[model samples]
Target: EPEVTQTPSHQVTQMGQEVILRCVPISNHLYFYWYRQILGQKVEFLVSFYNNEISEKSEIFDDQFSVERPDGSNFTLKIRSTKLEDSAMYFCASSVTSGEAFFGQGTRLTVV
Candidate 1:
C-alpha cells in the first residue's frame, strides 16, 4: 500500500513570513487536500484539489493561503504571510474517493 509523504516534518518560522509545506500524495489518488489541527482543536479543512484545480476551500483558507500541484505529482501549500494562529500540525491527505483519505505524518509548523 502507498502513503502520503510530507517534507520537513517540522518547521519553525517567524510571523509575517512566507512558508511552503510540501507533500507527495499517493499517485493513484484523484483528490488532494490540506488540513490543519490547532493543537487540541479538531482538524480543519483548508482546501481540496482535483483535476489540477481547487474544488473546495474553507473560510480558514484565506488569500494568504494557496495550493498547487505544480508539476502534477507534488502538491504544496503556501502561506504568504505567516500568523501565530497558523501554527499547527498541517496534514496533507489524498483519497481515491472523497469518503476515505490517507493522511501524511504531518508538518508541525510553529510560527513565532
Candidate 2:
C-alpha cells in the first residue's frame, strides 16, 4: 500500500541552525498535514495545506516554520531556527478527509 515516507528518521541539530524535514505523501491524497509530538506528549497539529496554500495552521506554526510542495511527489517542512524545545517527533500525514488519515513513522528532531 502507498503510505507517507520521511527521511533522516533521526536528526540532531544545533540550537540555532536551519533544518528541513522531508516527506513523500501517498500519491492519490489531496490534503496534507504536519504534526509534532513533544517526547511523551500528545500529537499537536502544526499545519494543513491544500491547493498549494495553507488551509489551516495552529498557533504552533509561527513565523519560523514553513511548508511547501516542492514537486509532484514531495512535501517539505523547514524551520528557520531550531531550539532545544523543538526536539520532538515530527509526523507527516495525509487524508482523504478528516476520517481517513495516515501517518509516516516520523522524523525524530533532536536540537541540542
Candidate 3:
C-alpha cells in the first residue's frame, strides 16, 4: 500500500539556519497536512493544502514556514529560520477526506 514517507527521520540544526523536511504523500490523496508535536505535547496542525493552495493554516504556521508540491509525488516543508523551540516531531499526513488521515513516521527536528 502507498504510504507517506518523510526523510531524515532526525535532524539537528543550528538555531538560525534553515531546514527542509521532505515527504512523499500517498498518491491519489487530495488533502495534505503538516502537524508537529513538541515532545510530550499534542499533535498541533500547522497547515493543510489542496488544489495547490492552502486550505487552512493554524497560528503556528508563521512567515518562517512554507510548503510545496515540488512534483507529482513529493511534498516539502521549509523552515527559513530554525529556533530552539522548533524541536519537535514533524508529521506529514494525507487523506482523501477528513475521516481517513494517515501520518508519516515523522521527522524529528532539533534546533540548538
Candidate 4:
C-alpha cells in the first residue's frame, strides 16, 4: 500500500532557528494536511492543502509557519523561527476527499 513518508524522523534545533519538515503523501490522495502533537497534548490540525493552495488553516498557522507542496510528490512545513514551545511531533496526512486520512510516521522536532 502507498503510504506517507517524512524525512529526518527526528530533528533538534535551537530556539530562534528555522526548521523545515518534509513529507511525501500517497500519490493518489487529494487532500494533504499538517498536524502536530505537542508532547502530551492531542493532535491538532495546522493546515490543509488541496489543488496546490491552502484550503484551511488553524490559528496556530500564523505568519511564522508555512506549508508547501513544491512538487506533486513532496510536501513541506517550515517554521521561520523555532521556539521551545514549538517542539512537537509533526504528522503529514492525506485523504481522497475529506474522510479517512492516512498519516506518516511523523517527524519529532525538539527545540533546545
Candidate 5:
C-alpha cells in the first residue's frame, strides 16, 4: 500500500530559528498539503500544492512560511523563523484527486 512518509518524526528547535520539515508522498499522488495541530487544538490546514505551484493556503501560511517540492519525490515545509506558538504536530498529506488526502504520521515540532 502507498502512504505518505515524513522525516525526523520529532524536532526541537529554538525560537527565531528556521526549521524544515520533509515528506515523501505516494508516487502517483498529484496533490500535496501541509496541516498542523497545536498541542490542544484542532488540525488546521496550512497550504496545498499542485503542479509545482501553490494551489491554496490558509491564514496560517503567512509570509514566514514556505513549501517546496525540491525533487519530484519530496515535499518540504520551511518556517523562516520559529516561534513558541509554532510548536505543533505537522502532517503531510497527498491524494490522487482533490478529495480525501492520506496523511503521514506527523512530525512534532517543538520550539523553545
Candidate 6:
C-alpha cells in the first residue's frame, strides 16, 4: 500500500535554529496535514492544506510553523526559531477527506 514518506527520520537542532522537514504524501490523496506528538503524548493537529492553500490551522501552528506544497508530490513543514517545547515526532498525513488520514512513520525532532 502507498504511504506518506518523510526524510531525515531524525533531526537534531539547536534552540532558536530553523529546520525544514520534508514529506511525500500518498499520490492520489488530495488533502494533506501536519501533526505532532510530544514524547508519545496525544497527537496534536498543526495545520492542513488543500488545493495548494492552507485550509485550517490550530493555534499551535503560529508564526513559527509553515506548510508548503512546492510541487505536485512534495509537502513540507518548516519551523523557524525552534524551541525546546517543539521537540516531538512530527507526522505527515494525507487522505481523501480529513476523517481517516494515512500517516507517515514520522520524523523525530530533537532540540539541544
Candidate achieving the largest TM-score: 5
lDDT of 2 by residue, 17-104 (tens): 9999999999888899999999889999999989899999999999999999998789899999998999999999998777477999
List of clashing residue pairs for candidate 1:
none
* TM-score, structure 4 vs. true: 0.98
lDDT of 3 at 3: 89
Q: What is the lDDT of candidate 5?
A: 0.97
Candidate with more favorable, higher TM-score: 4 or 6: 4
lDDT of 5 by residue, 12-97 (tens): 99999999999999999999999999998899999999999999999999999999999999999999999999999999999998
Better of 5 and 6 by TM-score: 5
Ten contiguous residues with the weakest lDDT in model 5:
92-101
Where model 5 places Cα greater than 4 Å from the true spot, the runs are: none
Cα lDDT of model 6 by residue, 1-112, tens digit: 8989998799999999999999999999999999999995999999999999999999999999999999899999999999999999999999987589999999999999
- lDDT for each residue of candidate 4 in 4-100, tens digit (9 for 90 to 100): 9998899999999999999999999999999999999999999999999999999999999999989789999999999999999999999998779
- Alpha-carbon lDDT of model 2: 0.94
Model 3, backbone clash pairs (residues 3+ apart or across chains), number: 0
Work out the TM-score per prediction: 0.98, 0.97, 0.97, 0.98, 0.98, 0.96
Candidate 1 Cα deviation (angstroms), residue 53: 0.6
- Arranged by lDDT, best first: 5, 1, 4, 6, 3, 2
* lDDT over C-alpha atoms for residue 50 of model 5: 98
The stretch of ten residues in a row with the least summed lDDT in candidate 2 is: 93-102
